[model samples]
Every structure is written in C-alpha cells, then in structure tokens.
Target: MRGTIVTLGGGGFSMADTGITPIDELLLGLTGKRRPRVCFVGTASGDAASYRERFFDAFGARAHASALVLFGQATHAFTAPQILLEQDLVYVGGGSTANLLALWRLHGVPALLEQAAAGGTVLAGISAGMNCWYEGSSTDSFAPLAPLRDGLGWLPGSACPHYFAEPGRAERFGEWVADGTLPPGYAADDGVALVWRDGALAEVVSERPGGQAFAVTAAGETPLEVRLLARF
Candidate 1:
C-alpha cells in the first residue's frame, strides 16, 4: 500500500547497542524486495558522519544502504530529492525535531517524501523522526519537553514517542491531549513502532515482548494490540 510510515518510539538499528532488531527485519520485509534500497536521512542529527556510518554498518550486508547528507556536502550530482525518490524506504535519524522540520521544508524534502510515498516507498524513523510525520508531538527539541504542533501532517493528530523509556511522558502526553494542547493520537514505548498505512493505523509491532503502544484521546488512553516480531 502507498503512504506506509513506520513510527518507532526509539532504538533503531543504529541507535541500538547491539545487532539488527526485529523492527529492522519488519521494515525491510515491507519493501517486498530481496535487497531493498534504503536511504538514511540524518538531517535531524545535522547529517552526522558517524550516524551515517552506523546506519550502513547495521544494514550494509542486507540492503543497498546510503545516506543523504544535507549539511553542505551534496556530492551526488542527481540531487538529494532524487536520492529519496529512488529509495524503497527512507529511514530518518533522531535529533532536534525543530531543526529537522525546518531543514526538510527548505530542501523540499517533505514534498518529495510525499511523492516517494505515493510511489510505495516506506518512510520510517525513531523519536524525532517519528515526531516529524504527525500533526504535532511532545518534544525536547526546545531543550525542554514542550508541545510542537507544526509537523508534516502526513498522519493526523499527534504522536508521543519513548513512552516507556522516558519518565513522566505518559502523564504529560495524556495531559496534553486532554487539555487540548495537542490533538488526540498514538504513543509508543521504546523499541515499539506504529505502522500507519494509507493514513490510518495499520499495525503495531515491537522488538520488546511486553512493549506497549497506546491510542490516546481527549477521553483517555486505550492500549493497542502489539505483535512481537521475534515470535513470528
């Protein structure tokens, strides 16, 4: 299906201390290709070279992995947007959400991403990466946990990541949704991901066995069923 986006709470292949996780396998499987072309967008982390290397190190063997650099090094002649449009999947790195949004717009990435999505390219990311796709999110991009309502809006409502790993995130997200600071939306624990397909919640998958995901509204929080990837 087109418009498939996987929003991970945290702990991606590069972010994790160990090897590839179930989340990684699950994402690659979505491409329905033997060796998918995956582009790592590290703009959120300011296009850090080490982060890019970590990405390739994690995925080099199984996929045609490449990183898109936006901090002055535009080595490829085709253009950054072209690089994204060509991928089977685009994985964004986590960092300051505010910076990510601004830079994406300037580079015309959001529009190209929409184009890529329309062509069946899957978009995925953790934390800030996840936060940027929704209408809004509770983020620490401002040096404090705050409400950021300016997002790509590819997916409706809001999103809250690191639900389990971050202390007080559950209460804060619930409060924001209830008090109208943010729209009703989904939340995910670290190592868990919410897969949105064709603009609706499609599946919830996790690397951790007991990891939780939630559907939070002005009314309250409802738990969503999570499928542990390792079991499958």
Candidate 2:
C-alpha cells in the first residue's frame, strides 16, 4: 500500500489558524480506523527535554508516553531498525543531518524506513528531519560545514527548507539548480508544507507567513529555471 510523507519547515508544529501546524491535519488525513503507532528518531539531544519545549508541550503527555523515543547517541546499531519496523508513524526529529544520515546508514535505518513506508507507514519530520528524504540539501542551518550526501532515495531530487527566509539561500539554491548540482525539487519557508503521496506531489499548504515551492529543471543545456506550483 502507498503511504503519505509530510515535510515540515524548521519549526516542529504549527497552528491551524496560522496555517503552519499541518501536523494535526496530516495526522487526521492519515488516520483511518486505527491509531497509528508513532516513533521519533534521531534525538541526538539524548532526551526529549533537549528538543523544543513546544514539542513536548504540544504533544504533551502523548509524547512523554510514546513507546520509543530513540536518542541516536545512546543506542546500539542493531537496535534501531527493530523499533522502526514496529512504528506506523515515524517522526524524525531535527538535528545534524550528516550525522543522522551517517548513523542511519551505519545502522541500516534507511532500508528499514523504506520497508516501513512500503508497509503503509507515515514518514514525517521537520527541517533536517524533512531534508533527509530528498537528494542534495543545503545544511545552511549548520553552515560553515559543507553539504552532505544525497538523501535517502525516497524522492528523486533535492529539498531546500527555510528557503526564502535566509539571506542568499534562494540564490545558492538557484545556483545549485542551474549548475545541475542538485535535481529538480522544492524550497519551503517557515509555515509551508510540501506533501507527497503515491510518489507524486499531492498538496502544498501554507500557514502563517507562507513560502514558495519550486520545481527546477534543466531547461536547455546548463542553467535551471525555478518553476513555481499552485498552493495546496
């Protein structure tokens, strides 16, 4: 069965009035007859406390009581996948994308994630959490460091979040897209969410101060033009 993938901006969750907190809507959309088994991965912060207080506050007792909150720094390589396999909603927390991806590769998490998705699990996350799914992504949040590897091949191209908010980010993204360094993909700002279902873009929604999503393709032989899509 095909599953849903929700990509959020840097902020963890958003409010419906503001239009940014699409998580609740995403959850509502995914829920059918049963509650999904949720799991959070890449909590290198070691504890839920290190994450944004809003997460715990928003999720509240629900998050505190989650069955598995895998702190990447503390677990062994072999233990992660077993827990991942049991989850129906796997929410990857934001951290160092390079480190997270490295550890995931080392521990066989990617294959497990793909397995989970194939089994109809919902894969969702914010910032690095979302960036890890696409091809090349800008690590501007953790800048002074170089860009890392192509993301888990769940999607065919690159993803740039907090795209228009950061200065020169859009320019850098344009350069990369034009240079053929990264594939045609998206650029999301604070409150917008880019959703993909059944291997195609199903929706792109805005909340609060909205941002843009671009589809950059090689128009001629070199330069890439950023093509925009309708808001979901």
- In order, what lDDT does every prediction score? 0.88, 0.60
Model 1 C-alpha lDDT per residue in residues 10-128, reported as the tens digit of each score: 86685578557789888899999999999999888888777877888989998999877778655332336668989999999899899999988998999889999999999999999
lDDT at residue 155 of model 1 (Cα atoms): 91
The C-alpha local distance difference test score for the whole of candidate 1 amounts to 0.88
Q: Pick the candidate with the highest lDDT.
A: 1
Weakest 10 consecutive residues of candidate 1 by summed lDDT: 72-81
- TM match of model 1 to true structure: 0.94
- lDDT string for model 2 (71-137, tens) is 4333323233677777667777666677777767766778887888888777887777778888777
* Per-candidate total of colliding backbone pairs: 0, 4
Which candidate wins on TM-score? 1
- For model 1 the local lDDT of residue 47 reads 84
